[model samples]
Target: MSRVVFTLALAASGLLAQAPTPGPLVRLYPVALDANGQPVTDLTADDFKIVDQTKPQTILAFHKPRNEPAAPHEVLEFSNRTSGVTPHATVILFDMINLLDADRLANWKALDKALPQLESGESVYFYVLNLEGALLPIHAISPPAAGDKTWPQGVATGFDKVMKASSHIRQAQIGAEEQVKRTFKALEDLANKLAAFPGRRDILWVANGLTTVPDPMLPHCNGDWVECSLYVPHLGVTLAKDRVAVDPYALVGNISPDVNYNMDQMALLTGGHFYSRQDVRAVVNQVTQGAVGGYSIFYDPGPDNWNNKWHRVHVTCERKGVKLQLRERYYALPDSRPAVERMKAVLMEAFQNPTDLAEIGVRTKISPLPDGKPGVHLDIRIDPSDLLLREQGGKYSGALYCLVSDRSATAPLGEPSVLDLKPELTAEQYKMVMKNGLPFMQDHPTSDTAREVRVIILDQNTNAVGSVTFSVK
Candidate 1:
């Protein structure tokens, strides 16, 4: 029988079962600094007030100067040292469908310079917001260099195609307004991706600024594009059909003369800054400071989410002489779904389309082969573990699949293998096995001691969802 069939049979026989309790909430603090390049480390809880809408709320946990590295226990075995709470992971947001030639080059130069200095812990992901949909990673690149020489050339080509396509559509007026709406809708999709990630993530959004399509028949009197670009796109349009006009200037307004106003607003709320000038180094510096200075604060609103709405946050300096400016606010909506459901959403995104996952977990266990060759088995674990799909009724029905990837430069120890996890196994169980049961290469006796190995998981037959990386030395 095929592996999928075999796994399913195993599940039916009750060989696997779910685990109790959900995973712990992973929280990281992001600090945002101002122009003077000072870290806002002295604020107290009372000095900062969180407001969901206009009402006041409590602050659950707060930390200042939260740039310290996670405790050793908190660090992943494969974690990069530089990956701590430092504003190291940089996201390059390029809007091909909406950006002009000048804007495009400006973005490229900034990314090129920024990609190199990323510490081992620091990560970089590139995205392009256009009508083709939110452009996720076409390929994953590791540190030392996130892109090959040819990668930039390829990205430039994609940008050209999107621009060309936009020009073609701009020429057709049968739905001129509609076409623009679709394009902005694509940008909003990009926003959703950003919001889903941990708050205070750094994103360099390079675009022509945000524009709201005109409509004057809605309460709160805001335009649809702003809501879509700011909150949720579909809901934004449904409630904003008669709200506003497409005024790009008002949407982003002076943050970055070049970036879309709506896009900039979203970035600001997420604790990221916008850049428009072409001074590549300067822009990079700004992004670095923005990411480093901003911090993410999380709190539980006492479970009284009776009327789900957006909650606002305001941070003030407790010290008398210091001035505090934070990304204006965040919407506190009720997340009724269990953490597992949320994990699944992220897994689907990482493993399927929109490769936004910045980190993955891989567990390995080591054993000796009959011939005394060191053999290692690895399991890559991801949250919302249901992604590892199993076959049912002769069709693919599982959500996740595991594959072993070999990056070994030398020797023939053995090829990697994919582990077909039984569907009945819970995500937590998968994680435990992957985390603690993974083989340790040191315990294995192998002639080929110099090789790199990775356990990679896939979702929907696309994108690498989770990966465990190690080298046999």
Candidate 2:
């Protein structure tokens, strides 16, 4: 049996320079804003205070946006993208579930003016939530065509079609409670779907329901204006998992004190900004800017902090007049530990949807093993510069967890092979790998079958994943 081998400049160090797979730590994402409502990216670790369950926790790691040069070395055969930048999208989700006809007309007028003003180089999608909480795509979500500048015309065309058909369809006469339930369900479904996208997406939720109506599914019965209306309690956590921000833009006639309060909660809970008194184009630009300039906070809450209850998380900047947008609460009891179970889920998701992941730059080649043994050789080329590495005590360290498997074969190569490599290197070795990417080699015993063979890799530190799937005949 052949074991996996990594070829790189990893010197033998006694200080445990090879990073160990760390336990799950709390990761807080905060989007800071200036007094004029713009993303603030220059703040450092000392500028903020984070309190969990009313107790201050020491900041273990602070990660700014990955501003490194995305270009790979000229010697590498393949990298993440040839475009030299990560692709993002703007999703405009309009809620037509309970909109009055007059309000719809007003939105149409505003959007008509805003559509021509919308400027973007990334993907953009437009959809509507129908009466039954099903998404009706006005313009389906897709990556922008290379060198295609006519997308704005396509958006105008799609909107024109929806406008012509709007007069014929009547709004469903549903109860307030049912409408609220449907709105919550729509948001849940949308978040799950958006997880497949590549980078962080900004959702322009042009809705009249989620903010204007109080949640009916919340178990408590206190009828206070803003405090009583919890949007089903679990909605915030669900949105946070998908790496998408929910920027709520209320319709013209739906603005109320209760509506504004609920809208603020939706934005705060999902690390998004409320687009009040703004046009569609301006809102998209600001939200996109925030996504580009957000910062991530990592703090290790010891095992004793898991009290199996919901804990409130408060992040405030020491600099006055600066506002921070972040998730307000986190459940103490996560679904599973990250060592085995969470790693398994990450592998499965990557293998199942290999094309959707590209954070870690990787390329692969498969062929018959040279040892005259009945096995196939698998070689993976990894770009080390894309990984999140930590430098401590004159050494650089990073961890990688990988899986290689084929789900279709039962007679052979059915069982998934899991490999974890945590490499620690001296400063010289780190410089060598940075100049020339790292190479990985492995082999799998298999029979003659043409099936989907997938190799999934996960960067343990940042949870960045990449995969490659090919058929072996």
Best by lDDT: 2
Q: What would the per-residue lDDT of candidate 2 be over residues 264-340, giving only the tens digit for each residue?
A: 77776667777765767777777766655667677777777766555678888998878887777665655556354
Winning model by TM-score: 2
Question: Model 2 Cα displacement at 145 (Å)?
Answer: 7.3
Per-residue lDDT of 152-225 in model 1, one digit per residue for the tens?
A: 43454554555455545433332445545655565444444443332143445555644445443334644334
- Candidates' TM-scores? 0.50, 0.77
lDDT of each: 0.41, 0.65
Give the clashing residue pairs of candidate 2, or none.
none
Per-candidate clashes come to 48, 0
Off by over 4 Å in 1: 1-30, 41-47, 62-77, 80-87, 91-170, 174-181, 188-200, 214-264, 276-278, 306-308, 320-327, 331-333, 338-473
Indicate the TM-score of model 1.
0.50
